[model samples]
Every structure is written in structure tokens, then in C-alpha cells.
Target: MTAPEDDAAGALAGTPEEQRAALERWRLVLGEPGQSVLAGGQLSEAGAGRDAALDWLYGRDEDLERRGVRQPRHGGDGPSVVTTVDWLDDITTLFPKETIERLQRDAVERYEIHDVVTDPAVLARIEPNPTLLKAVLRTKHLMNPDVLLLARRIVEAVVRQLVEKLATEVRHAFSGARSRTASRFKVARNFDIRRTLRANLGRYRPEERKVYVETAYFVSRTRRHLDQWQVILLVDQSGSMTGSVIHSAVTAACLWGLPGVKTHLVAFDTAVVDLTADVDDPVELLMKVQLGGGTDIAKAVAYGAGLIEQPRRTILVLISDLYEGGSEHRLVRLVRDIAEQGTKVLCLAALDEDADPAFDRDMGRRLADAGAAVGAMTPGQLAAFVAEQVGR
Candidate 1:
């Protein structure tokens, strides 16, 4: 019988043709494993480099010990750090950019390799992609003082990217809303002659030679009071909600600077942290969020409800998966009460790029029954929704 690895590779190494075919498939998934299997007991220069890269990623220590291939020891007490840097450097050549990023993300998430982000040597060898940057953001509390600056730079870069992608669209929507409001006919003092002519053009009679103002347009001088607008973002910071949390943080930061907008952000898990003061800086706000914890939707909603001085002027957005750890009845009640107070309430399963989210659909339906509009939405859709509510 063949070894389990060979069985996994789907070839028993009976002939040269079978061996080569299996070897190629194994190399794609297994990275590097046994020397006898990969090299066929005859290693060449190109094969040796491939073996080294594969070994760093997928080689088993037991197989190395069996082969009697003694691993070299680096100088100092930082062997893991040195080994990590070497692994990163090797994988760059061994994998495509997408695969490399996936591997980096896997390593960080599975192993909790915070050292890779902080160690200058590892940082030097690899590019800081969004996955790694998000990991760094998630683990901000675990970061050392020495790496704080580098971490800040990474967070800033990622935040700026998100802001650049989202700011213009959201701002334009808000501005468009304002323009519509500003153009509303409050007094109807002056007729818009051009618009009047365009409207009545199809109904013109050559014999009569006269166009009637059937629906005359008027220029209004009404100005929207921006100061009356209140936006409260209640974000769930549970581990599964990382993507939503990142988006909510950056969004809050963007909305905070809007003229006449009073934006308040609350990040909650089992514990709630009012991040409104830090909303001006998304990096700082994100760093303050503790990602893994039990969720309390009622507590968060109740807190947000207290912040609403005028419910009619407020837009309350609850960003969560609706997996309540607290009293579900209370959560539903609070959502109903808030909406009844005239506040426009939105219950989002998530506010990320992935519109089809895995969440508690039953709970979302419950909230919907209680008067809140519950659904999964991309950030762009959420932005438009916000503009529509605020402009109302």
C-alpha cells in the first residue's frame, strides 16, 4: 500500500509517468513535503530551489528528521522571526500575488503571527496588503510600542484607500439631496420659463401660436438646516463582524466631517464603547474596537436611543448580524420604540462589499416586523440610503 500522502496525491508511484503527474499535482497543493517524493532521490539545481521554498511552507519536521537534513540555526534568540522572514521571501517567488496574499492572511489568522507585522525584517521582505493591514487593525491591542508607528502607517494607508473609494460617492449623494431640497419650490415666486417651454413643447398648436404653462416650475430659496441632522451608527464589533466594523469606522469618520451632521458612533460587543470622540480619526477609532466578544444588540440599541434628542431629526443605523446574546424581546422592543419615535431605523446584517451575508435571518425579520428595514447592503447602497434619510 502507498503512503497516505501518495494516496492524497492520487498516484502510487508505480511508474515514471504516474510519478511525474502526481508530483505536479502534489506541488500545486502540498507546497513541499517529503524529499524522496518531490526529488525522486535525484535533486537538481532548479529542483533544489523549489524544494527549499516548498519545505519552508509545507515540509514536515518528522520527514526532515527521517532524512537527517539538519536545519541551520540562525544567530540570536529570534529564530521564529528570522524563520518567518525567510518563509515570506521564499513564498513571493513560489506563489502568485493572489496566492501569496492568501497565504499571508492564513498565517496571520491561524497562527496569530503578530511578529511578522512588527518585525522590520519581515515587513521589509513583503508588501503590506489589505488582508494583513486588516489583521494588524484587528490586533491593535496586542501590538508592541515599537511597531505602533508602522502599524499606524499601515492603518492610515488602508483607511485612505477606503475613504478615497467611498467619500466622493457618499458626498455626492448627500450634496445631490441638498441640491434637490434647495431647489424645492417653497414660495413659487418666479416661473422657470425654460422648463415651462420644454414641458409645453409637445402640446403646441401652430394655428393658435401660444404655449400654456400647464405645470410651471419655480425656483425656491429654501435652505436645509444641517445642524438638525443626527446620524447614530451602532456597530457590532463581534469577531465575525470585522469587515463591517472596518467599514463602519471609516464611514463614521467620513460622516463626522460633513457640515451640519452630528455623527455619533457606538462600537459594541458584550461591552459598548462610544467612539464618537475618535470618529474624526478612523485609525484611532478602529484601534479602540475589541473584535471578539458576545453581542448585545438590545444594550446597544437602548444606548443609541438615549442619544436621540429629537427622533424625527435622527437616523439610527444598527450594523449587526442579529445574533443576539441579550434579551431578544428587549432588542425587538427597543427597535420598535425607536422607530415609533419617528427616527429612521435601519437594521443591517452587514455593511461590507459582500452583500449576501450570513446572518440571523429570523432575527432580521423580527426587527423588520418591529418597523426597522433589515437587510444586507454594500457600503455604497448604505451611503445612498443614508443620504435619502438625511435629505428627508
Candidate 2:
């Protein structure tokens, strides 16, 4: 009759039997460390199976003995990597989906898997998720020419898939904006049927049951606005933003392809690299991104401002954690100046799928007070926001 949460709490803090059972479960998950909780306790056969699976992931006793090493030293490699494919496959069966994902991420960080992922055998053996994919792209600078090319292919595939998923909604939102009503004097191809009906109601011949059409309602023909609006995707390429960098690159490419919008992507980390020329190719654009460096956000903001020829027709999207390494006062001043000049500025705390991101709330508030909209959003949501902005 107890709720699952209550059952869980009972297992951990209930009767002695229940506590012992829960301790056995912990031993399975925490391995050697967990064994201390159940030092004199024993597990049932089923519990033993669970313990073995946990040991497979967290236990390093056997691995240490074989490799003749303890834990990894600072800036040094681990004793020996547990093969990614084997570990992931095993954990996938044993753990819940979220737990499996967490374990996989841990394994990646623990094993330095990105360095070897380019190998044909390794690439073929594992399923690459977003986190791993981001890691691969992040390490492109260290890869050889051949391996780098393979990494680009992987990035392109992932980006292409995202584009496919987002293309329809983006086009729809953008097209809806271009469907503005034409002036009454100038007959647009799109007919204003309701308006025409209202204007001609007086001319309705009730006796004959005929409404005479003195004026024809012609719908305005669809117009494509190529290079009419400018979109600047100013991304922060610091160490913590690797995932954001990858997704932002792909989103920038999508924005670039949309008619009537000229998209410019500038990635910053103390230095700015304008990848506008390669905007059409997300793969190439992402390859040029350098992930770890100090952040000079004010300078990047200044550079982005310089690109705006017409502030009224531009949208500046600044993606970052908002930990400004440069002058905060100057950054605030610049943002306020741009907003006052009629530029539509949006400061995204992050542009990744993770809902809760660690960002500077104080800075976000300051930017918002200065007329910038600040929040964390996924790429798809960002595309939707862009579509809404352009549509207006």
C-alpha cells in the first residue's frame, strides 16, 4: 500500500531486514566502497547478480592488478580502458536509461575515448550519442588529417539529421511572417476574403440573394525575402560549452539557409573566429571552433556589433554561460547600446537540451534589464524563437 518513494525510503531506513537488503543493493552499485555498508551481510542470488553488474562498471581491483597500476595520475592515462562497446552494452542491459547514459558519459571521461573513436573498429563498435559526438568534435584539433575527416563526416551526419527535423517548422514560422497583409489600394495576390466581405456587405442584394462584387479580393503572391534580415550567432567556445558549440553550429547553418536572413557565426574564447564564410557547411564551421580558452565576451559583442549595418533589421543571439572574462561594465554598456539602437538582442544562457544549466544569473538579469531576453533553450526551441522573431 506504500508509494514507490515510501517503499524506497522504507528499504533504506525501515526495519533491519529491509536496511540489510538495501545495503546489498548499494554494494552492487558502489562496488568496493559499498561493500563496507554490508561488511558482515550477505546477498541473495538475485542480489549477487546485481552486485556483479555493478562491479563490472565500478570495480577496478582486477584491472589494477593486471595493468600494475592504481588510479590515474594527474594528466596521465588510466591503467587500462574498459572497452566502450562492451561496457555500454553491459550497462545498457543492467541500468535504467538515464543511469546508463550517465555511466556512458563517465566511461568516456574516464577512458579518454575521443582519442580512439576515430578508429574504424572503435567507430563501428559503439553507438555515438550527443555527448560523445560533442566530445569527438571538441577534440578535432588533436586528430590527424584522416581521422579529422572521419570526424567531420560524423558531425555532418548528426547536423544533417537535426536540420531535417527542424527544417519544416523553421520554414513554416519564417514563411508565416512573410505573409503580411497588403494595403487595400495595392491588391496583393493573397485575397483578404473577410475584409472584402465586410466592405461589400452594403452592396448585398438581399432580394436577389446576390452579393455584387465591386472589388475583387486577390491574395498576395508568396514572396521570398533573401538577405533581408541579418542574424548573428555569437557563441562562447569555452571548455564548459562544448555541447552548445556543436548544436549552435548546426543551428547557425539552418539559419543561414533560410531565405532573407544572412547568418553570421562568431565563436569566441578570448579570440574571435568568424566562421561566416563556412556558415553553409556546419561541419567545416564546427571544425574551425577552438573549445578551450579565456572568454572575452565584451570584445566578441563589439565584433558582433560591428557586423550590424542596419540595427533595425538585425537579430543578435549571444550564446554563453555569461561568465565574462573581459570587462563586465563594457559588456553591459555594449548590450544596452545595441538594444537602444533598435537591434533585437537575445542572450541564451545555453543552447543545449539540458534544461538546468550553470550560468551567471546576475549577468542574465543585467542583460535582461538592458532589453535582452535571457534563458536556456534547446536548438529546436531556439529555431522556433528565431522564426517567431522574423515572422514579426
Q: For candidate 1, lDDT tens digit of each residue in 274-381?
A: 999999888878767788879998999999999998888888999999999999999999999999989989988888877767789999899999999888888778
Kindly list the per-residue Cα lDDT of model 2 for residues 300-332, writing each as its tens digit: 999999999889989999999999999999999
Using TM-score as the measure, the top candidate is 1
Each prediction's Cα lDDT score?
Answer: 0.76, 0.74
**Candidate 1 residue 108 C-alpha distance from true site, Å:** 1.5
